[model samples]
Target: MTNSTLAQLLDPAITPRLVVKVGSALLVGKDGEPRREWLTALVAELAAARARGQDVIVVSSGAIALGARRLGLAKGGRGSLADAQAAAAVGQIALAGLWAELLAGHGLTAAQVLLTLDDLEERRRWLNVTATLGTLLARGAVPVINENDTVATEEIRFGDNDRLAARVGQAAGASAVLLLSDIDGLYDRDPRLPGATRIPVVRRVTPEIRAMATGGSSSGLGSGGMTSKLQAAEIAGLAGMALAIIDGQPVAPVGEALASGRGTLFMARPRKGARKAWLGGKLRVRGSVHVDEGAAAALARGSSLLAAGVTRVEGSFVRGDAVSVVGPGGDVLGRGLCEYDAGECARLIGRHSREHEEILGYAPRSALVHRDQLVLI
Candidate 1:
C-alpha cells in the first residue's frame, strides 16, 4: 500500500488508542541534554492527538544518555553494566523532569512509569500495569514509560525500547504503535546503498521480510536496530496491533507522519478480545487434548470441549494450565486453559458430561475446556 493510502486508513480521529516510542537518539542531543525544541514540537503533536480523543502512551528512552553526560562518562559506548545502571539512576530524574516540564507547557500532565521485563512476564504484574496505565489515560494523563534500567540485570533486561514499546502497546490494548527513529522506514537493502529503496507498507512480516532486516541502530545513541524493530512488529502483529516506523527528526514528526503516512506501516490483523489475545500470545501449552470429528465440529460452532468428545489426553499438566486442542486428523484446532489435570482427563475421556461427577468424584465443570477460556487458532 502507498503511504498516503495507509494514512487515510489510519485516521487518528477514528483510531482511539496509540503508542508512540521515542528513541534516545531523538530525545537527547550529542551534548547529553534534552532536545527542547524537538520535544516541544512532539508535545504539540501529542496534544493534538489527545484533542482528537486518542489515548496516547509514550515509550521514551534517553536516561542513560543524559546520565552519562552528567556523570562525565564516555559518550558513544554503553559502559559496564554497573556504570550503565548508575547512569540510569541519575539520568532518570532528568528525563522525567524534561518530560514533565515540556508536557506541562502544552497543558498536559505527564506520569512517569518504570517497568522491567518481569512486569510484563508475570500475569498478575501485567494486569496491574495495564490497569494503572488505563487509569492514567482515563484521567487525561500521558504516561511516559521507560525500562527500569537501574535495577534490571542482563537476564531481565529488554535491552531495547522497540520491543518494549510493542509490549506496552499490547498490554495497553492500543490500536497502533508508532516507532519514531532516525531512519524513515524499512528499506529493501542497506539504505546507504545507491539502489536501495524504502518499503512503504508491510501487510505481513514473513521470513523473507525478516531477512531484509539489518543489525545495529541507525544512531549511535540508541540500542535497537532495524532487526529489533522487525521483532517488535512481529509481536504487535500477533496481538492484532498496527505499527509504523517513521523518521523523528522532522518538525511535528508524529502528526506529519500520520497525516502523510511517510513511513513503513505494518497493517494489523483482525483484532481479538483481551482474553483471546492473552490465550494466543502469552500462555505456554503444556498438554494436548485430541477430540473426535463431532467434537471438532462442535468446537467450530463455539461449543465448549466436553470430556465425551475427547479421545485422548497427552502430556502432564495441572488444572488451569494452557493446552492444545487437536482434531481427529491430528490437526491443531486451538488452545485453552484446561479444567482437568492429565490423569483426570484420561479417566473422563469419551464419557458424557452428566457422568463427570461420578467418574471424577467431583463435579467441577461440564466442559474439560471452557469456551470462555478457549481461543481458536
Candidate 2:
C-alpha cells in the first residue's frame, strides 16, 4: 500500500471517466434510511465530473442499512442470514428511490443496474453488461449500480461493492475507480493503532504493504475494511484502470482525490491496448470455440479465427467480443474476440472465410474474429 515512488498525481476534477464506490458504512447515518442530504452533496460532486465531460458510474451500498433500520431489525451483527436478506430486499427500494431523486436534482437521470457474481462470471452475460454500460455512458446517463442482494447467493458474493466497482470500471474501460471509505486512504499501518502513519499513495501492493492492512471497521459502518480495498485495487489494476482509496465521509473527497491525488493511488497494469492482458486476467470464462490443429497453428502464427479451421463452436456468444478457442480434442488453444454471432458461427461451420459473402449475402469482414483481437491461451 505504501510505495510512494509508484504513485502518480491525479485530479478527479480533471479525470474524464471514473467509477465511484460508496460503502454502506459511509452512506448510512446513525438514523439510517440513507443520510438523505449527504447524498445530495455527493451528487453535486458527480455533476461537476459530468460537466467536465467525464463519465461517472456509482457502485453504492446501503440497502442492508436501510432495511435493517426500517424494519427495526438488529444492527448488532447478530442477525441471521435470513434477516439480512430480508433487510436487503426492503433496503433496495429505498436506496434506488433515494439515488433517483438525488441524481435528478442535477438534471441528470440515474439508472439502477443490479448484478451478482454471475453477471461478471459468465462471458456472454459479462459482455452484455459491458456493452450496455458503454451505451449508457455514451448517452451521458449516470448508472447507479449495486449487487442484487435479494437473489445473490452467499457463495457468489464479491464480498463488497469495492470489488464490484473495480470490475465495472474494467468492463466499461473506465479511466479510474475511486473507492470511498471512512479512512482518508491507505496507511503504513492501522492508524487506529499507535505509531501508524497515513500513506498517501501506493505504486504496487507488495507483501510487506499488505501486512499492514486492517480488516473492516470498528464503527460497524464498514465491512470490507482496508483489506477489501486492497482486493479492489488488484481487480482494477488488472483491467488497466487507475485505483484510488479516499475518504467517503467528506462531501467532495472523491473529486478532491481525483484532481489532486490526495489519497492512495494504485497504478494501472503495465501495458495498455494489449487484449492478451484482458484475456489472461479474465474474471471468468463461460464456454469455448473448438478449432483444429491447423487453426490453432494459424492463430499462433498471427492468423484470425477463420471459418475453415473452426471445427466446432461451443457455447453461445454474441458478436464483437472475446472467446476461447479449443483444439479438436478440447484443449483450449487460444482466445479471441469474435466477429459473428454464435448462431452464424454454427451456420458457417467448416466453410471458407470467402464463403461469408456467398452464404450470408453480405460479408461482415473476413475472419469470424480478427487475430488482433485474439489471445493464445
Candidate 3:
C-alpha cells in the first residue's frame, strides 16, 4: 500500500492479456440510453490495444438498466425478479447491437458472451469458457461479456459485475484487469471529506485498506461500490492478476489513467498455475478429507493424496467441489477440487486404488486430491 506509479501494468508487453470492466452507471445514462460517445471512445482504445497484439476483453454491465428502461420499469424502484429477467432479455439484444456496431466501425469484430456464476464456478464450464475466450482472441474478435441476468437467479448470480470481471480475468488467464468506474481510485477516506487522498498502489487488501473502500455506488444505475472493487481486487490479486480501478467518465479513460498513473493498482501474487491459484483462493470449502502423517508428508513431497491415506471425510460435497485436505493432527493443510463425491470418498477411505472398483462399483480417479489441483495454504 503506497502512492507510486504503476503505469507498466497497462503495457502490452508486460500484460499481454487484459480484462476491462465498465459499470452500468458508466455505460448507461440517466435517461436509460447507451452513452454512445463514451462507449465509442472506450472501444477505440480497446481496438488500439488489440491492434498492438494485446488480448483485450471487455466486461460491460448495463443490459438490465437498458432493458428496464425499455420495459418501463422505474429507476430505483423494486421490480419483480421476473420483470428484471424480462428486461435483461430485451436489453441484451440492444447492448450487443451497440457493441457490434461500434467495434465494427473500428474494423474489429465483436463477440457477445453471457455468463452465469455457475459457468465459472463449475470446473467443466469454467474450462469451456476459458477455451471459448481463447478461441475468440485467437480469431481476432474482442469478447464483450456480461452476466446472463435473464437466467441467473439470486443464488447463482454475481451481485456485482466487479467480482465477475475478476473471475473472468482469472478464467482467461489474464495478466491484468481494469475496472472503469465513477471514481478515480481508492482513497484513505471518503473523497467528499477533506484530507482524503487516493492511494496509488495496493500491495495487499488488508483490513485497513478494506476500511478505506467505504461508500456505495454514487450512480444509482449500478450495484457495485468501492467495497465491491476492493473485493474484485482481492480476487484478481490472488489469481496472479493485477487489477486497476480508474474513473471512466473521461474520454480515453484507460489511456489517460495509465499515462498519469492516477488509479490504484493491486499487485498480483506469484502464481504457479492458474488452476493452483484458483484452488488456493476459493472462498468456501465444500468438504474435507483427513489424512495420516504419511499422506501429509507425501503431499509435502508433491505427491497426490490417495484414498488409502485418507482417515476420514467430513461434510457433503459433490465431485469438482473445493475440498480441504486435512492432516492427522486436525490441521487443515490445503484445498483442491475433489475427484469424487463425499459419499464415494467416505467409502474409499483407507482403501487402496486397486480396491476402488470393489468398493464403489467403479474405479474413478486414483488420487483423491491430485497434486496439480492441490494448493497448500
Candidate 4:
C-alpha cells in the first residue's frame, strides 16, 4: 500500500462533502460544560472549509458525558440504561444549544438530527434521513447528528459515535470522514511502548491492521477506542470515503491536521453510485427472489426485475426491505429493495404487469425490483 498524507487528500481542487466526528473527550470539560473556546476554534475551521465550497456534517458525542456530570453519576462506569437515557434527554438540549450558538456566530445555522440504529438499518428510514440531510445541506445549514439515546435500547444502540459517523458518511455520500480524538493516529503498538510507530496511511484494512487495534480508550468521557476507530475506517473504506484519525486536543485541529498531514489516512476505493453502495454494504437481506434464465439475462442487461420474471419467493420480508435476487440454479445475481412484501410477491410471481392490479387489488408498482434500486454483484 502506498503511504498518503492529509495534505494530499484535502486538496483545494477537490471540494468534498465532509463528515466530522468529534468525541466527548474533546467537547466536554471537567465541569461538565461545553468547552467553549475549543469549540469556537473548531467552528472557525468549519467556516473556513465552507468558504472553500465544502459541505460539512458533524457527528458529535458529548450529551451523555455532560449529562452524567449534571446528574452526579460517577465517571468511567457504564451506568444503568435508564439513567443514561434520562441523562441524554437532558443533555441533548445543552448540546444543541452550544452548537447552535457556536455556528450561529459565523452566520451558519445548525440543525439537530437524532437517529437510532433503525434509521440506518431500515431502507425507508435511511431514504428519509438522506433526503432530510440533503435538503439541509442545500439550504446551507450544518447538520449536527447524534444517536437518539433517549429512546435507544441496548439492542438498538450504536454504542459509539465512530461507527455512527461512518454510517452517516456512507448514507450522505460524503467524500471524506474525519475522526478527531485524543490520539493523533493509528500506531503499530501502543505509543507508550518504546518501539511503537505510527502508521501514516492505510490502503486496505486487512486482518493484520485490525489486529493492531488494542481497544484502549484515551479518555473516560468517550466510549470508542482504537478498535472502534478501525472498525469505522473499514466501514468508510467500503463506502468509498477517505477517513482520517487526528488529534483533537489542539486549537483548529482540523486545519492543523490538513496542513501538517499528521494523521492516519485510510484511502477510499472508487465510489459506487448511492443505490449500489447501500445495496452492497449496509443492507441485511430478509428474503430471496429466484428468477428464470430470461429474467437473469434481463437483469444482466440492466433491466428491472418484473413480476413476470420471478419464479419463487423465499423467506418473509416486508415491503422496502432488501432482498436477494437469485438465478434459477441458486446463483446470487444481486440484491435490491423490494416493492412488495413476501406474500404479495408470492401471489404476483409469473403474472404480467397488466395483471398486477387485478391479482393484488392494488398496483403500487409494476416491477418487483426497480433498476434504480438493484445492485449487480
Candidate 5:
C-alpha cells in the first residue's frame, strides 16, 4: 500500500463493516461474574455501528467462565475436557441470553450462529455458514457467533475465537476486526516490566514484534492470551482487514478507538474478495491433482482451473465440488469447482476441452471451472 495513504484507513467516513470478537477476559469482573457494564458498553459501540448501517458480528467467548459461576465450578479445574464441555453446555444459554438482552436494550435483535470447525473447513458447509451470517446482517440482525463447544472435540483450538473472528471478518468482508481484550494494546515486552512500552501501531508484522508477544489467559477460566490476540491480528490482516487490539477494560474503549484511533492497528494485506479468500486458503481435501509447469505458471498468473493441463487426478469427487489443484512437485496452485465427475475426469485427463464429446459421451461445460469459480491458492 502507498505510504501516503495510511490516514485514510483511520477515517470514520469509511464506515467499515466490522466483526468484534469479545475476549472472555474482557467480560469478567473482579468478582468473576460477567461485567454487565463492560458488555453494555461494547454493545453500545456495536449499536453505533449498526446505527451507521454497518454490519457487526460478535464472536464471543465467556460461556465457560459464566457457566462456571452458575454451575458452582468457579474455583474448580479438575474436570476433564468433557467436564468443561458440559460447563460450556450450561454457559452457552446464559451467553446467548445476556448478549440477546443487551442487543434488545439497543432495539436490535441478537441471532445466535453456533458452529464447529467442520462448518468452516467443509466446502458445502462453509458457503452455507457465510450465507447465514450474511442474511443475518442484511436483515439488520446482529449475529452473535460462538463455537458449538458442546459438540466440538478440538476444544483447545479456535475455542479462543481468535481464528474464528478472523474467518468471520473474511466471511463478512469486514473492513476491520476489533479484538477486545484486557490489554490496551501491543507491548514491547510483558506489561509487568519496568521499561516495557506499549506499541501503538504495527506497520508490518516483523518477527521481533511477534517475539514480543506472550501467552495470556481468557477470563481466568478460558484459553486465549495476548499471543492469540496477535495471532488474530495476523489472520485479520491477511484478509484485507485491519485488526485493533484495544483495551476491553473501559466500557468505552470501542468508542475510544472510533473517536481517536487509540489501539494497535495491523493493516490489511490488500486481499481478494471474501469468497476468493475463503476458496483460496482452506478446506482440507481428500486428495489432489498434479498439473504441468505451464499450467502452474498460468494459474500463478491468475488463470482459472482447466482440463488439459491436469496430468493426474488423485481423489474421487463429484462434479461441481471443491478440489485441490497442485503442481507435479506437490505444491497446491489453487482450488476450484470441478466440471466433471472423477470418472469423467480420469477419461478427460490431459485432453483439450474441445475434445470432450469424442472421449466422453457428454460434457458438463467446456471449462473445468470458470475463472470466477476458481481461486488461486
Candidate 6:
C-alpha cells in the first residue's frame, strides 16, 4: 500500500501506537558490527512518527549476535545455551546503548526493556509490563524491547524477535506492528524462483498462506524467517493489531519502502478493546470473591469492587491472580485481577476502606478489583 493508504489505516487520531521490530540482520552485520547508519535512519523515522503524536515501541534483536562475536564463540550462535546467555549479557549493554545514543540525537529518551515469555504469559507480570510501557509512552519515551536472553531459559524463550514483537504489540495495545525484514514483502512463491510475485496485502492467514512461508534465515543471524513472520502476523491479527513486513536492507530512509507501496500489510481483526479481550479470553480464574448484593449491583453499574462490598473470599490465590466475582446468589458477576491476596481479602472483607490500614497493618490500594481490570461475564 502507498503512504496515504498506510496513513489512513494507522491514523494518529485513531491508531496512535505502533510497534516496530528490527531483525538481527538489519541492525547488526555478519562481521558483528552495529549498522549505525541504518539504525540512525530508522530512529529518525521513529522520531518523525513521535512528532506526529504517535507512540512508537521498538522490539530489537542483535544482542546475542554481537555478544557471540565479543565472546569469540562459534558463528551463528552455535554454542551452549549458557554460552549464548553469556553473550547476551555482554551484547545487551551495547545494543541498549546504541538505541539510546541514536534516539538521544533526536531528543527522544530510550527506555531499555527486556522481557521473557513468562513475563507476557503470566497475568501479573503482563500487567506490570503493560503499565511500564504505558508510563513510558505517556512520558514521551521510546521503549526499546528485547528478549531477556541473559536469564530466560530455553523453555521460556520466544525463539525469535518476531513473535516477541507481536506479543509486545498486543500487550501495549498498539495499532500495528512493522516487521523490518530483509525481504520487501511476502511473495506468492519463493522470490528466487521465476514468476514469483509479491502479495501486497493479506486480510487473513489461511492454510494456503501458510504454505507460502518458508523457514530458516539465509543470513544465519536471525532466528526467524518468513514462517515466523507469518506466525507473528496471525498473533497480532488475533489481538486486533495489523502486521507489515518491509525490507530494511535499503540504504534509503526507514519507512521508504512502505511509503512507496513495497510491503505486505496483514490487516487486523476488528478490535474489541485489546486488554479486555485478552483478560476475557486467556485469564484462568484462580479464586472466587463472593460479593454482597450491593456490590454486585455496583459492579453492574461499572464501578470498582470496594472492600465493603466483598462478603467473602474463596480459593487460595495471591494478589494479581484472576478471580471470579460471585454475587450473593452464587451468580458470577465478573472476573478481574485481584488487588489483594486471598488472606488480605479475608481480613478486609466487610470492612470500610478507612479501616484497611488498621486491619492490614499497612495502607494498600483501595478496591478489591479495579474497574479497568475487571470484565463482566
lDDT of 6 by residue, 1-377 (tens): 22324554346775689999999988998888899888888888888888888899999999998888888889646477888898899999999999999999999999999998888878688889989999998999999999999998877888899988988988888988888898988999888999999998888787789889889776778899999999788778767778888888987435577468788889887665666646543324789999998999999999999999888888999888889899998866677899999999999999999999988898879688999988775
TM-score of 5: 0.72
Error of 3 at 135 (Å): 0.8
Worst 10 residues of 6 by lDDT: 1-10
**Which structure is stronger by lDDT: 5 or 6?**
6
Per-residue lDDT for 304 in model 1? 95
Writing each residue's lDDT as its tens digit, candidate 4 over 1-377 gives 12366864454355378898999989998778889899999999888877778899999999887787777876522478888887888888999999999999999999999999889887789899999999999999999999999999987878899989989988887888899999999999888899989899889777788888878786878889999898788768767888899999999998887777788999886677876777755535799999999999999999999989999999999898889999998877888899999999999999999998988897559589999988765
What are the lDDT figures for the candidates, one per model? 0.85, 0.75, 0.86, 0.85, 0.74, 0.84
**Candidate 3 lDDT, 51-139, residue by residue in tens:** 78789999989888899888898752227778778889989999999999999998989999999988887778888998999999889
For model 6, state the Cα shift of residue 347 in Å: 39
Task: Give the per-residue lDDT of model 1 (tens digit) for 241-314.
Answer: 88889999888886677676678888777777876766655434789999999999999999999998999999
- Candidate ranking under lDDT, highest first, comes to 3, 4, 1, 6, 2, 5
Per-model TM-score, in order, reads: 0.76, 0.70, 0.80, 0.76, 0.72, 0.72
| Tens digits of lDDT, candidate 5, 265-310 | 7776777776667765443454576788888888788776677888
Off by over 4 Å in 1: 1-10, 75-77, 258-260, 279-377
Q: Which stretches of candidate 6 lie over 4 Å from their true place?
A: 1-4, 7-10, 273-377
Q: Against the true structure, candidate 3 has what lDDT?
A: 0.86
**Each prediction's number of clashing residue pairs:** 0, 6, 0, 0, 1, 0
The TM-score that candidate 1 achieves is: 0.76
Candidates 2 and 6, the one with greater lDDT = 6
Give residue 182's error in model 1 in angstroms.
1.1
Clashing pairs in 3: none
